[model samples]
Target: MGRKNDIASAVIMLGVALFLAGCPKQALEPVGAGGPQPQAQPQQESPAMTPEQPAMQMEPYGGASGQGAVRLDQARQDFQDADIMFEYDSFSLTAEAKKVLAEKARFLNAHPGMKVLIEGHCDERGTAEYNLALGERRAKAAQEYLVFLGVNAQRLSTISYGEEKPLDPEANEAAWAKNRRAHFVITEG
Candidate 1:
């Protein structure tokens, strides 16, 4: 029994590693070795903080405040936080889902270079096979709606988690409703 359990654990770990390896590339920001990072240049504070204060501040590139970075971060947060929800056993988009997708479409249009991954998920009431298909349909529904709203289809990819990943694990209508959603991830920009 112990050996069997060990093998199961090993298999699960391997599956997770493989899944992560197959996932879309990380954020547009460079990663690992050989990536050039912005270096900070020492600059005098502009009446905000006196030099007498023993604190160091880095000047942003291009002489602009970090407002651009902040805005981009907020936009990314807003994008990921907004999920397109669906009814049980149905892949149809509600009016609210369409509105949310419209807002997402606007964000995508503003950031033309961004690429996204849409993940479809489901409640825990169905067989894995059935849920996977339903989840895929839900994801595709959202993707189609985004395309209809003028966001390029090429920028979007879809995957279904089905009942494998529930937003709320509790067995209740609210939890089930929360789990039936299409989530978003920014793959690259």
Candidate 2:
């Protein structure tokens, strides 16, 4: 009976050992030359992904105290020869517009005694009131830039004709672009 009991206990121990051997092994340390794998890097955020700001921001023009003598004929000529373009539905001057204005400024500086009126115009897109406002904005932008470029504020005046005066009369992009401008007319002459 003792021998039988001993044999049963030995069988039970063998079964326990087989069960543990069949179980999966836990990894105690990293494997080969690759070692511990590095974690994936997070993606960087981009400025382009963000929404843009509003377009109506007006920069302040430092007033006209630093002006010099300018040529009248040259200024008039430059004003006549200057070509300014605006974006669709906008009166803001682009880099090209700025370059033209700079030349105009040089002319104005040469002719200091010349007093001119800047006529603001717009294409026939919106209501008269809206167009008038846009035209005024264009005129004011030109005037302010001139002031910044050392042209006397007193010599510069602004007016808005809105869509009333169409330079091309044709209802096309070129005509509309032509209409959306700040034209100079010598008011004091």
Which pairs of residues collide in model 2?
69-109, 70-109, 70-110, 70-111, 71-110, 71-111, 72-111
State the C-alpha lDDT per candidate: 0.74, 0.62
Q: What is the per-residue lDDT of model 2 for residues 1-189, given as tens digits with 9 covering 90 to 100?
A: 999999998877655333222211100011122222111111222221212211111011111111101122343465775657677668888999899889888766644446788888888877899989988899999999999999989999999999999788998888888888888876653
lDDT of 1: 0.74
lDDT of 1 by residue, 1-189 (tens): 999999999977755443332221111243222222223212212332333322222221112344434445666788999898999899999999999999999878755668999999999998999999999999999999999999999999999999999999999999999999999999877
Candidate 2's C-alpha runs over 4 A off are 1-75
TM-score of each: 0.68, 0.58
Q: Which candidate ranks first by TM-score, i.e. highest?
A: 1
- For model 2, what is the alpha-carbon lDDT of residue 71? 26
Which ten residues in a row are the worst by lDDT in model 1? 53-62
